[model samples]
Target chain A: MRCEKSGRIEVSNLCKRFHKAGKDPLQVLQNCTLTIEPGKLNVLIGPSGCGKSTLANILAGYDSPDSGEITIDGSPLKGPGTDRLMVFQETALWPWMTVMENVIFGPTVRGEMSKKEAREEATRILELVGLQDFKDKYPAQLSGGMQRRAELARALINRPKVMIMDEPFRGLDDLTRELMQEYYLKIFEKTNCTTLFITTELEEAIFLADRILIMTFLPGRIKTIIDVDLPRPRNYHVLTSKKYLQIKAEALEYLIEEGRKCFGEDCNIANTMVDEFRRQADNRH
Target chain B: MNIYFVLPLFVILSFIFFIFYRQQKRLAHYSGISTLSQIKKTLTSQRFWLVILGFVLTIGFWYAAVYWLPFDAFHRLPGPDEVVIEWLSRDPYYGISIYTKEYYVHILYSTYRATVSFLLATILGVPFGLLMGWSRRFYEYSFPLVEMIRPIPPLAWVPLSILMLPGVEPAVIFVTFLVAFFVTTLNTLLGVQSIDQAYFRAALCLGASSKEILYDVVIPGSLPYIFTGLQISMGAAWFSLVAGEMIAAQYGLGYLIWQGYSLVKYPTIIIGMVTLGFIGYGSSAVIRYVGKRLMAWREQELGGLGVTYEE
Candidate 1:
């Protein structure tokens, strides 16, 4: 289900550097160029310290690139605005506010909708996220999964042009994380809004992305872009599919290579141990 | 026993019982037990019995020290029984008690001074602290001045306050306000600093204006610390209020205590001390209640975790 095309983001030669006292400037992102097509889910996959989050911050206008340009629908972005909303990895739902209040915060603050309209829209969005029962509950009262859902509702109600999710489900348990990935896919399929989702998980990238953009180790840059041609309306069943396995294997190769560069030989030894253990289990079976 | 002593004892016992009954009811609600069973459980609980035993032991020690001890200091001090009787007496031997207009007047004056000082401190301190935390330039310029002045004790300001202010009342208030103001401003500043940077970034990304960020993100984010500061400030206000009152005020609990000493009424001094304790406890309790109401989100967090209540 594709919606109207509006949120097309273009990044050209984006670069950023952080300077520490009495130390040389550390380059975070170097000549990062990418295009997030309107109405598509683009997953940017990378290892830890790969500057993917920094790139996400730059795109969301929370930080500016040292040198480069970012345009949304052919207009250069000036500063943080309602047009680009970010769903942070850490829980950012205002704990003081109830789920309903958090969901309606953007529209109410921006004066984009009337109070009645905002409430109605927020109610619909909460229902969509299956949080209608917990609308009156505070973030502290909710579980991690529910808080993430509430955060998503907070971002979605605004109808932002580009939704930047920076490792949104990074800290969830395995079961909850998978459930959220499936749940997120449903919303993405329905809204078909342009999304730049960042993650370190290869399986998550293959499971949810319309296109997977693999980033190198710091100083980060796009290493490869893999188009996911898997059938839509994705679920856990896709994990065992032949196409899914092929995409995962390919993405794993690049990820492991980058992970090795980032974490050095330690990552390689850990990877080898896992492979050895897998072989032993397979031989027993 | 006299009616005055008997009536007050009954009221105090009833209040304690009421608190226990309410607590049992709440426990029963959470644990799905009958209130009677919960009350029974509470009575039989070792924790409850231990607290009772501890109180009994302390009072027994006090009684022994006053009646049996040979020390001169022990002989001069009033026992718990003597203080309680004198506190409730209609025609008190020391000329201050439940029936005395002077006692009520002293209490009213002290309470009035503390309340005014606390209100003033809050009005000035919160915004000042917010600006200090919000703007880098403001913090750099004003924080040094605050640090320089904060270390000097509020009591140390009494003589200077008397010399500078128009009257004794204003002087007492000024001295009390100084301590509370410093506490509130520092806590509020720390509260703002404690806020996670992620929240600010989220607000900016959500397209909230600077004013909206302050109201929605910064204020709410720093509220837990602000409430904590307010509670501490309330305590500080009373602390300095009593000191200031003792030095300069003509009517206050502090003055009553001082006057009792000068007049050689040891029982009156104990009565004043007990009254001060109850009022100070009540004032802090009010601030805590208001803080709980304002930050219901924090209450839920603490409640969900089953953290025990502490003063």
Candidate 2:
């Protein structure tokens, strides 16, 4: 999908290695290259244990790739900066700091402005997040959904060029998750931020992303990129539509195939041979 | 157990009654006139007299312990009267001046020395903790040395303190400082380390300098831990002060208690012990009170509990 190139985030030839048992090296992401369009919600989805989270971490500067280049608006990403703010799945709002203080924390610490000025800026963001009343309340005082909102407010308060998220709503109950999805969509509509979100939830990825980058299993690489040409501010009703079901089925098929591959199971099978194969395998065992 | 035991038992029972009475009184005010009548009925019961009886019983036990105990190995020690008489009628060679009642003087001396040393330790310990807590290089290099030295008791340093310092004041101060210094430093370090990593990330992303992180994030984040260290260090100061005085001093409470031991004056020794106990308890309460007030923000996060450390 063609979108405004106001902020382009690109990762080229990304490579990362982690130490495994027996001092054996496990390559996490090998020569993975991708370009995320500016002001578009790009979702990364894959089967469990895939390297989507790792890639997101690399982009967020939480982890460094052994060799790669990640550039935002043509500037290379070296370490964590206000240029990119990350929202984690489990809300990482500071329990000690109040909602207002947590939101302003980044700006106040980084900005040359006075405390009063920083607070005013924070107040504006708090209102935007529908948490104006929770300014004085600690994270514990907030509901789980509210905490996530506060976390989003904290990240967005800085007006970062790219918003990177890792399973941002994985743990919430169904109702809360749906509510958060709606809330998140509304916020995205307002800001139009270039977002790179990682999730294992196929439906969530399809619903939120302009382009969903499906990944293969371990030592992950992009399996395919499915562009969701859905209209802006897509709602829950759109989930049951023909196009939505078509996309969901395709994503599910890809994931199930990947799962079979990981488990050493053949993806294709015949009904007659299934029983015979099981009997043969059982006899051999 | 008899009536002697009855007094303590009664005191405990009466304490329970007082708590219930207070609860009823609070409920009465909250629940309007109906509950007021109920509260009054509860209050009018003979439970109040039971409290009075309990107090009388305690006095009776005291008099019995004082007047009737035979001067034997385990007899209830001297009653208040005998102890009072002994206190009043004693001929004072030096008298009860600011310097004489070694109980009072020793308390003063011990308190002064411990306070001065603890303050000095705080001045050094807080900064050191902040440095070690905030700086990777400092934490990596200094933490190992601190860990090795921290477990070594302050009493172990008394000999070194005496040899190193030119005077007795220096020695006592050094020993007390050592006792409190580690607690303050380690507590501050933990406090700094325990601060949410997000706070640092938030600040760092904001373009905060390392110096700003120390002053703005690490110090404030670790204040609770620093206060905790100070409180613990106060206790350590008292402990080390006594040990220091016992080994190489002539004036503090420990020295007086030691002198009383040499002379076989058990009461004097007990008085000195009580004095030390009272000072230690009093200082702790003060530290806790101040810590709570200063760390009001912590209470919001941790309920009424002062500071709850997270693993």
Candidate 3:
């Protein structure tokens, strides 16, 4: 897309395990490997609880992989830095701070930029996120979608090379979710920063990504990677287009296969998913 | 000595009231209302009279129980009128009343000891709590001591405090301090623990330093619980203060009550109890007032109910 993002992230053979005190060690991410090209949007799609979030956390340097090497632009990616920022699913905008304060929290704490300069930068970024009107309101006072926008504003102000978002709009209502997806796509095209978005929503994955990585069930491994070759400035109308339906069907098949493997006596989750995908496939915008 | 303590208290109180009055006036003007009329209306309201009536009936029951009870079970109890009569008269009796310098001296001494002890507890305990909450090593080092010491009543420390400190006054203050200190430390620790993990992760991703985390995350995050702890600590401070006063002090409401008990001048005991009740209530009110001021964020977040614990 010819963007200005400066870092290339290479996560090779990443393996992570969580140990419980009185039980067997549980493996989460297994031999996960991927390279996120700079200035591109890459979405990781998988079933719920499939370690996509754990992978995102590792990539963002919030947690270390038990066995792996992560490199950013050929240099070893260190623990959390200004180079990588995360927007949490729950929108972790500091409740104690106004939107403006949350946006400037990074630079203010680091003192890398002067207070006035940070304030100016924060204001600019908040305006871009369409949160200029809510600059004085605390996160508690904002709606769920507004809170997500505020979080996006906070992350953007840091000017990170890679922004990792874990199900950033998962909790919004259906209407808000659709609007947020459109809004997010617009923001991503402008910033053109490398973004790795983790979500189970297949439609969201297709809409946001230049590349999509599908993962298997628990002990999650990268099943396959598909490139979304849709033209730029793709809107909601593209959902009805033939090429998008073909891609959506392909993604759905991969997900149904994975979902079936996790089925139990009580949970017909896979069958339900298949039916839902079919209904969505039939109902064109 | 009475004048020295009483003078600053008057000055400080007047200054506070002056600020409060100005704020009230400014707010009233902004709202297009008069403060005096509003206050007068509030004073004359049904709710106000109901509260007054409730108080009189409750006290009337106490007086009736003392005067008209059939047995000697309530013999030591004095009617409210008896306490009032003693208050208005001179006390070779060593009671709380406007008539005596001795009463003021006792009140001032108790206030001083309580103030010094409570301040020390907060200063020492809060940081200790933060350390324990923030670092695993600190929790390991101190948690066991806290777990052991916290459950034991502050009164239990009275004998040990008497042995440890050189003077009676210091011992008494030490006991009171222990009660408040433990409350602040434990509550501050819980506040830190209760903070969402997402905030810490978000701050780390933003490249915040450990020091920044302490101030921005730990302090603000734990503040709600810290305030809850302050209320508990203040109550404990009063409890320990009265216990120490009764046991070791030459003057105080507690000492007066004890003296009245020993002499069987029962109305002085009622005066001491009533005075302690007022002071305890006052101290707790002050803590809550400070809490409300510092936690204005929570007040707005919860829409002013001050009781919601849900995230």
Estimate the Cα RMSD of every predicted model relative to the unseen true structure: 3.7, 7.9, 5.3
Best of the candidates, DockQ: 1
**Chain A TM-scores, all candidates?**
0.92, 0.88, 0.91
In candidate 3, list every pair of residues with a backbone clash. Answer: none
Candidate 1 vs candidate 3: the lDDT winner is 1
Model 2: TM-score, first chain: 0.88
Better of 2 and 3 by TM-score: 3
Please, what are the lDDT tens digits per residue for candidate 2 over residues B1-311? Answer: 34543554477579877867777776666555565586776668798678878978886776775567564542545455444333343343223222245557777788889999999999999999888987789899999998898888878888887789898888988988886988999999899889887677656766778887777678778888888788889988988888888878878888877777777565565556666776898898798888877766677667543322221
**TM-score, structure 2 vs. true:** 0.80
Proportion of native contacts found in each model? Answer: 0.64, 0.42, 0.49
What ranking emerges by TM-score with the best candidate at the front? 1, 3, 2
Question: Stretches of candidate 2 above 4 Å error?
Answer: A1-5, A21-23, A266-285, B1-103, B196-198, B305-311
- How much TM-score does chain B earn in each model? 0.94, 0.71, 0.82
Computed on C-alphas against the true complex, the DockQ of each candidate is 0.47, 0.30, 0.39
Decide which is better by TM-score, 1 or 2: 1
DockQ of 1: 0.47
Residue B223, model 2: lDDT of 84
- Give the least accurate 10-residue stretch of model 2 chain B, judged by summed lDDT: B90-99
